[model samples]
Target: MLSPKLEVVITPNRIAVRNVGSGATATADAPFSCSHLLADDIDILEHAAQGAMKQVVGGGFLPSYPIVEVSTGGRPLHQVERKVIRDALANAGASKVHFAPSVTDVDEQADARAAYIAAAKRRR
Candidate 1:
């Protein structure tokens, strides 16, 4: 079976996660400002990722490797910032990761995902 796709949106104060296939969604609030690139405390970002993953998974089973797409509220990320986000997702059991440009509407996320998948297929 194919692994599920997970989408995560990170902002300064919150992290929202959605399992695309299952439609299970969860959100985690940061104790302080926790933007992926600007935060002084990376641990808090990691913790928020963990907390959101736990909430989405709940008592249900989660695949060992899920395709994850993370959006940093439309801001571009530096190499270090990307690494920080990747590490957090890795801790949440993500194997494949994609970075999305900031999206405003919830519907835009689905469109972005479709475009990404199409581009990835062309690359292969």
Candidate 2:
């Protein structure tokens, strides 16, 4: 078994990565602050997050701070979501975990309403 090669792509507001020779990519918004660190073998994701933060801060997209504040675009890891994460981390042998809070997208309601309207129109 070998580690996959990762290709990092940094944008002004986004940070993304691709596994070399694979279609798998992971991305997150930039300028994130570290809320917690998990003491486990999940350092890959943590390192990627740090890299994205560095790019954004280094590029002057956001001010430099001791902690990188990442914006997760409103979807918070709570409720059922939190449960799913806890299960995954536990399964992965994570001894510790971190949680960062982000504002929920206010547009989710509007999006839902729009989808409902569209569906109604389609039915009509």
Which residue segments of model 2 deviate by more than 4 Å? 32-124
Note the residue pairs that clash in candidate 2: 31-69, 32-68, 32-69, 32-70, 33-68, 33-69, 33-70
| Model 2 C-alpha lDDT per residue in residues 57-95, reported as the tens digit of each score | 344332322222223344443344344333433332233
| Candidate 2, residue 24: how far the Cα is off, in Å | 0.3
Model 1 gets an lDDT of: 0.71
> Please, what are the lDDT tens digits per residue for candidate 1 over residues 4-113?
67899877768899988788899988853543343344678778877777666554435546788888677555566677777767866677878875632334366888
Compute the lDDT of residue 78 as modeled in candidate 1.
58
* lDDT of candidates 1 onward, in order: 0.71, 0.39
Off by over 4 Å in 1: 32-36, 60-63, 101-124
RMSD of each: 10.2, 15.9
For all predicted structures, in order, the TM-scores are 0.66, 0.26
